[model samples]
Structures are given as structure tokens and as C-alpha cells.
Target: MADAPQEIEALIDMMARLPGLGPRSARRAVLHLIARRGQLLAPLAQAMQAVAETARECLNCGNIATADICPICASEARANGELCVVEDVADLWAMERAGVFRGRYHVLGGTLSALDSIGPEELRIPRLLDRIEAENITEVILALNATVDGQTTAHYIADALEGRVRVSSLAQGVPVGGELDYLDDGTITAALRARKTL
Candidate 1:
């Protein structure tokens, strides 16, 4: 509006909606992108467009993938009879970045919450139960956050999967109310190593 081009303004607005980015940072980022249009902006635009069209939830796991089944779900090497359940895709990516767990992943999309009206039906809980038997999963590791909602969700899943598979959770190393994405690789590794049965 203030003498800025409509396209640039729109880009800034969209960037501002990204997590952890504010209007001020979005404006600066847009300006930097425009300055490096040929090298950065154009390619980034293309990549975003491509992902927007192709990105979808994996059928087996709830992880985002370009295909129906994510690479991790499709890989035989990852079918280690252990499944780590995370509350979000970012948490799954964080676990992958740590490179400590060799098993598959099950993304719950979100935690159950009565205040927000979210429930098991909304968070892929039923699908997870079906997957346990279908995939012959031996162990389920709850890598949910330390928040109240996160712990509640973990307990729900542990109860649901009891007797079907050995269920465990990330140990005390994870800070209270902390999300996995905020934890360092070493902490993730240590927590995973010290995981206790739920």
C-alpha cells in the first residue's frame, strides 16, 4: 500500500504468516529476496509452487510427503518393528535430524484437547491403532511434547496400544512443556536412550 508493488506486498504478507516470522522480519526477507531475485527469489518461488501442488499426508504414516507413502514408510530398512509417534510433522523432522532412531514414525497431526474440541477422531488415533496390527509394529515410542496436552495424548495412545505392542516414552531429559524441535541432537539421543515404558 505504501508505494510498494502489489506483488511484493503480497509476498511480504504471506511470509509474515510463517511461524516465528513477524511483519518486520517478513518485510526484510522480502527485500533481501527481491535483491537476489535471479539467484534466490525465482528458485524459491518455483520450489514453493511445486511443493504446494505435490505435498500430501502419507497414507501409512501421517508425515508429509510428495507421494501417497513417504520414503520412510516405503523403505524396508526403516521397518524396524519400532514406531515412534510424534504430535506433528516438525517433530518427525526433528527426530530425523537427530538421526538417533532407526525405526518408522507415526505423526498424530495434533494432540487431543477438550478446550479446543480436538479429539482422537481428529488426530489420527484410530488410524494408528489399525497400523499397529497391519504393520506388525512391536514397539511404540511416544515422542510427544512435555506439555499437558502432549502427555495426555501419549497416555491415551499408550492405553490404546497396550498389550498389542510395547509402548515407551521419551525420558525426563525433555524439558517441561518442551517440543522436540527445540531440543538439541544430543538431548534427543539421550532422551531416546533413556526412554521408559509407559
Candidate 2:
């Protein structure tokens, strides 16, 4: 097969760098887009440009927003005195997609990493504390990821707000469809510890 032009090859290279897309997939996608340039490629380019210009982080939380504050932060109904702490905007989006939690969110952007030299100051920890008091937060639900750095950050936050407000963490355990045999030792232990009596 003949090689794509330099510009098309560059687009393919950039698309391949996107998550879940390899070179073959990106090349196929580029071909598909080029085949329907007016329908898909032009609109996709416009959308990307729009997002690049308007997308920004919320001033209060780290969640993505086109405005200064996210809709969740602006909505009074979400001010239920409960704050859900998360590691990243993606995690906050995941919780919203589940529709299980009805509260405000605080995105930490990242967790503590001694190796990477990340600390509480690097994240939105200070802002989190400010919101806890300013928003009259009654409880802080630690919804951080199940990673070593995540847990360390959770512990640090828990200690910081120990006497000020109620602190709790999401229960870690096996997934609904997970099998005991498929679970790792750490997951199995966490599942057993988090088990509730019927």
C-alpha cells in the first residue's frame, strides 16, 4: 500500500498516542475520517478547537468546566454538607456516572508521591480544607483510588480533619461480578473485612 502524505501521517501519529488507540487503529480512523472529511473530520476539528479554547478547571474544585465553577459546585442542591474527595477529575466523573452519591466533589488532581515529590500543597488539599469549613461540610467521604499513594493521601487528609469533621472512606472490596478465585490476596482481604452481615 502507498504511504499516506506527511500531514496525514502526522495526524495518524498523534491519534495513535491517544489512549486505547494503536497505530493500526489510528490509521484506520484517519482513513475513515478522510473518507468522510466533511461529515466527521471537519466537525471533529471544530469540536476539538472549541474544547481547547473553552475547557478549564473549576476554581473551587479541580473538575473540568467551561466556566469558573462547575455546575455541581454552582448547584445549591449538591450542598448537602457532604464532600466526596477524589484523586482526579476522571474519578469524580466516574462517581457521577454511577449516580450513587448526592454531594459535592473535591478533585485532588493527584495523590502524594514521595518519589515524584508530590505533596499536599501540590494537590488541592488546602482548598479542600477551606471548603470543608466554608461549605459547612459535615462529612468527608474519601473516594480516592485503591493505590498506595492514594491511600497515603487519604490517611493524611483523614488526620488533618480528624477532630473537625467526620471522615470516612469508600468500602473497598470485590466487584459485583468478580469471583473469589480471580481476586488477588489484597482484594480478598479487603472484601472480607468490608463484608456486611445480612
Candidate 3:
């Protein structure tokens, strides 16, 4: 890094800041990109520029989009009267990657946290409530993470919409590949509570 040009060092530092990348990995990546500048670096730069210029949050759902409304929000087929609430755009993307959920989504940006001073007003809760009425949503499926803040946010949303619409949450429990011995107490408890007759 000491021998490298200032601009190259700066690029490495920037890449190192990305999630899952360390300084060593970033240095290697920068070297690789420099070696293949014509084939990879130029194209990557163009693509990044394009995305930076066009990407925006969907007006209705808060999903990342290149337009005012994301494709899911604009599609008539996705209006299934079910809204899946999530803690972030990453969560929404994860749900989409699974291809199991078919309805539209509402990204909350983040969970409520008293320590962080984050409340319902800080997220998209008010927008979510508005969408429930505007879209004639029949059910809201909370897909938040199992963290304490996530659960707290879910409870708050549930209580807020108690009588207005049917509200539910994704089941919490031990994962399919998890063993009882390896599972935590809370996971075991949730699994037992959610056990079925089958």
C-alpha cells in the first residue's frame, strides 16, 4: 500500500469498506481489476455508474428500483391482497430469491429500537398503514428477523393494525437442518409452540 499510487490506495480502501471484504481481499481485487481493466474494470465502472444514476427507492414499497414504482408494485398480477412487511430491502430481496412468497412487499428500512431512538415514525410504518387501505390489503405477513428489535417492531405493527386487517407473522423455530442439541432455548420453545398435528 505504501508503494502504490495514492489513487490506487484510495480505491483499495473504498473496496475494503464493503461488507465481507478486508484490506487483503480488496488489494487482491484491485490488482485483478487493474490487470483486466479493458475487460472487467471498464464494464464494471459503466454498470456501477448506470445503477448509481438510476436506482431509487420505490415510491410505494420502498424497494430499490430504477423508477418511481418497482416492478412488483406496478404489476397487476402481484396485487394478491397480501403484504409482506420486512425490516430492509435486503430482506425483501431474500424473500424474492426464495420464490415462495407471491404477494407484494413493504420494506420497513429498519426495526424499531429504543436504544437507537428509532420508532414507527422512523421507518415506513405510516406508509405501510396507508398502503394497507389504498391497496385493499387483506393480510399483512411480517417477515422481520427474529432479533428482539425485529420482534418488538412486529408486535407494535400487529397491535396497531389489530382490528383493521388480518395480521400474521412468519413462524419462528429451529431451522430444518438444526438439531435440538444445537438449537437455542428460544428457538426450541418457538418450535414446540408452533408444532403441528402431522
Q: Compute the lDDT of residue 32 as modeled in candidate 2.
A: 98
Q: By TM-score, highest first, what's the ranking?
A: 3, 2, 1
Residues 12-31, model 1: lDDT tens digits: 99999999999999999999
Model 3 poorest ten-residue lDDT run: 170-179
lDDT of each: 0.92, 0.95, 0.95
- Cα RMSDs, all models: 5.8, 1.6, 1.1
Off by over 4 Å in 3: none
Question: Taking the tens digit of each residue's C-alpha lDDT, what string does model 3 give over 1-198?
Answer: 489999999999999999999999999999999999999999999999999999999999999999999999999899999999999999999999999999999999999999999989999999999998999999999999998999999999999999999999998888878889988898899889988898
* Pick by TM-score: 1 or 2, better one: 2
C-alpha positional error of residue 5 in candidate 1 after TM-score superposition, expressed in Å = 2.1
Model 3 misses residue 132 by how many Å? 1.1
Query: In model 2, where do residues sit more than 4 Å from their true spots?
Result: none
Better of 1 and 3 by TM-score: 3
Encode model 2's per-residue lDDT on 103-166: one tens digit a residue. 9999999999999999989999999999988999999999998989989999999999999999
For candidate 1, the TM-score is 0.85
